[model samples]
Target: MLNRYNPHAMHQGYYRYPTISGDTVAFVCEDDLWTVPVEGGIARRLTTSLSMVITPRYSPDGQWLAFVARDEGHPEVYVMPAEGGEPRRLTYQGAERVEVVGWTPDGDEVIYNSTAGRPPREVVLWRVSLEGGLPTQYPYGLANHISFGPNGAILLGRHTGDPARWKRYRGGTAGVFWIDRTGSGEFTRFQPTDGDLTAPMWIGERIYFVSDHEGIANIYSCLPDGADLQRHTHHEEYYVRYPSTDGKRIVYHAGADLYVLDLATGENRLIPVELRSPRTQAQRKFVETDKYLQEYTLHPQGHSLLLTVRGKPFTMGNWEGAVLQYGEPQGVRYRLSRFLNDGTRIITVSDASGEPCLELHTPDGVTRFEAFDIGHPYRLEVCPTADRIALSNHRFELHLFDIEQRTLQLVERSEYGMIEGFAWSPCGRWLAYSFAPNERTHIIKIYDTETGAIHPITQPEFRDVLPAWDPDGEMLYFISLRDYDPVPDNLQFEMAFPMGMRVMAVVLRKDIPNPLLPPPRPFEETK
Candidate 1:
């Protein structure tokens, strides 16, 4: 087991894009290139560029190393000797982003992917000769990463969706495909599944790849024809990312530590690579907080503004007072800071006690209230009466907490799904919320505290949301998608309803007149 607390351990983090060639493995660590032996030992820094460098690939013959560097303010390809020397610049197309895929089998050229002079969503592969010249674009349209097979066919990994953002994604563009490079534009997709698959490596008779079909991503191997599939690694904690093979051994990263898998014995072993460079990035450094302002809200009396900067809450004056930070303890995260009814006390949800709890900040200091630990709460709302708090949990159960009595109450539980868009009335005697009866449309509903009655305000014909109570306690206002003005398409004559929403107000009493109607004029007495 790797000691995570040790600073000098191989699991110090920030190592990425591992490429193996013979007995050496080159990878990017903190905007520089470094190489370690396959058996694992002290790593030697190869490039000391000021800018960010990434995606290092060793030449097929192990004589040169090609990687992407942002020295000129944009990513471009550069090649250097395998034993650490001056890097020669390649690819002058000036792309905003470029990545070194791998070297051509002959070692005289390098294959890379770039998004230059094309749409941002599209990436085209190119081959640039090591002797320095313009690149030749491959015919493949949107390939992200590629590896050449023994027969010159290309094994492509296309990211139709973001792998990191969308976990356990099983969409149309989540699998690897084989592209015949012999002028045939013929493409064959791999086995179909609803799991994310990537990092295609064609080694010998088997094609190795990474798949999350078994819950967590692990190394898997299959034949060239997508037959005889087998799982190689059974890691369940962290996903095995960026696996590279030099035909003899497979190297990959699992939870910040590199592991090497011998193809002959199928034995996986950890490679303890000790980094000798100055650990400048792990040290503490000062950062300007004004640029990272996230959430802000106006003060109740409009005298100041409540702002959250880098998880710390602050109050800045509208015209007079200076900025005052809440000065919470370090390592504590406070979210959704809100002012109570009097504006003298601030209420926020914090995880300072390990689990999330409600905290009250006032002139008397901070006081924590333990109101029925439901783990972490969301969409916390303070009542106008200042004695009750409303919130929802991850399980979609709405709750109400009595501040003074230190008691909890279950407001409403959704049997169909989650109930959202809840608001308190001015008198704090009722709560209005919206939920979908079916899965099609959301309807507004009101809950009365005095009568304990729940009834729907709107029908199921349209979706209504964001309910707000009128200050006079006589009307309710909400947004509804009832307007259906459809615009015809110019090319196909198809009608498209483009987000027609309107604000609507409903009188709580039956005797109330329409607010938008013209008022009646008084008649003069017959004189």
Candidate 2:
């Protein structure tokens, strides 16, 4: 049985899209609808459907709850009693992507936004009747989050970019605007700023919204005419998102806790919400190792396969041997493990030292070394002679590290794009990598460590990648997209593939004979 829940003691799970009525707040927790008191108390589950439900909005009268649910494979608008009961489907033509905006002033219809017959960057607002009927689209062109104002005026917050993907963005599409629904279809910039603004809530004569103008996102308020701007919350750590108002108080999520700001007193307090549902996912359970496998690589000598599963490095025999696990400390992540030249040590990028650093695991012990000063190391390749290591970091800058000398060299800074698929020559004298010169194609380049000179191996017109050094160091092998063999498609009246890929070998020296050419017959000295 589940234990008695206490709101002040519980602090787990993600809560989103909160809408407050008189004193009760409806929100989504772990893809399920739930309700909790505004003064902080235990939450009661409202819906138990297996499908995901989100974006719950309360009716103006506070008797009905409207939300978007994917119970029937596609997201549709559903309305149920605010106190919890059977939900009635209102929109049959709901698309896979839909959001519950708010209810009409009369509470007879629930307004929502859908991507049906519209581009991904734009969504049209549609209002569906609570009695179940077709939804009517608003005359708006491109609006994501909207709030109704006096005289049929709409405070439109155009798509301000995805909050989950980008942060602190001040691009072109970053601020909110206003549009008049009953008049000409024209949008005017409201509260113009370089920061990203979203979640506009029109309460009385003031408009409340969240913006990252002062670094971190915080609650700010301005008049309907876009004057007398004031910042309500002074949050500088995490962004305040998904704010809702009941005309008296503003409730928003900051980090993992929900906070409510009293408009009159400007007092912000945490709304401790305790979940009484079963902790099925938090409970300890054995997980199958096979399904959690992330990466695998063959050993240099083909003796065993190195695998990284759930951020733990392990080695399993290719034919026969007991599995060996090289587990690190808690909260540390290890990636891209490769065998060293001695075959007794493994080099990998690990965050064991609180930051991403190069680590060498040997039979004796593990050794840590800082690889970069700015960005974390991503992919690395150990030289054949074990003298140098070529690696690229999160900043897309390639670097060469000398192990014995404990020195680092800036190989090259890729201005156009990321440098990828790099390999060290057999003699460890040069490094070959690929980078895109323009937006259309990639070219191969070689960097000589001894001379500190760089040279281009392939032209920028063709794309080349996956470079490998021929064991003798006389030729370099790479894959290029030069084959233009097109295959006609039967289903569509067009060519399926206009170009393919083929492996090409380049002789480093001009005196070296072409490997693809037939070998000349052995002749006597007379010739």
- In order of appearance, the predictions have TM-scores of 0.78, 0.88
- TM-score between candidate 1 and the true structure: 0.78
Candidate 1 residue pairs in clash (backbone atoms < 3 Å): 170-194
Model 1 RMSD vs true structure: 4.8
lDDT of all the models against the reference?
0.78, 0.80
Q: Tell me each candidate's RMSD, in Å, in order.
A: 4.8, 4.7
* Model 2 per-residue lDDT tens digits across residues 220-242: 88887777898888876778878
Q: Report the error of model 1 at residue 352, Å.
A: 4.1
The sequence of per-residue lDDT tens digits that candidate 1 reaches over residues 1-527 is: 22233336454656777888888988878789988997778889998897998778888888899999988778899999999999999988878768887877788999988898886667778899999898999877788777766656667777732344466877666655554544255777665344687777788777787888888887778777777888878776887877777778778777766777777777777667788778777677787866887777777788888887778888889988788878475688878787887888888888887888888899999988864675567677778876777787766677787777887778777665566678899988888887677777888888886686888899988888888998888899999988899998676669977768999998999988888898886687556
Q: Return the clash pairs for model 2, or none.
A: none
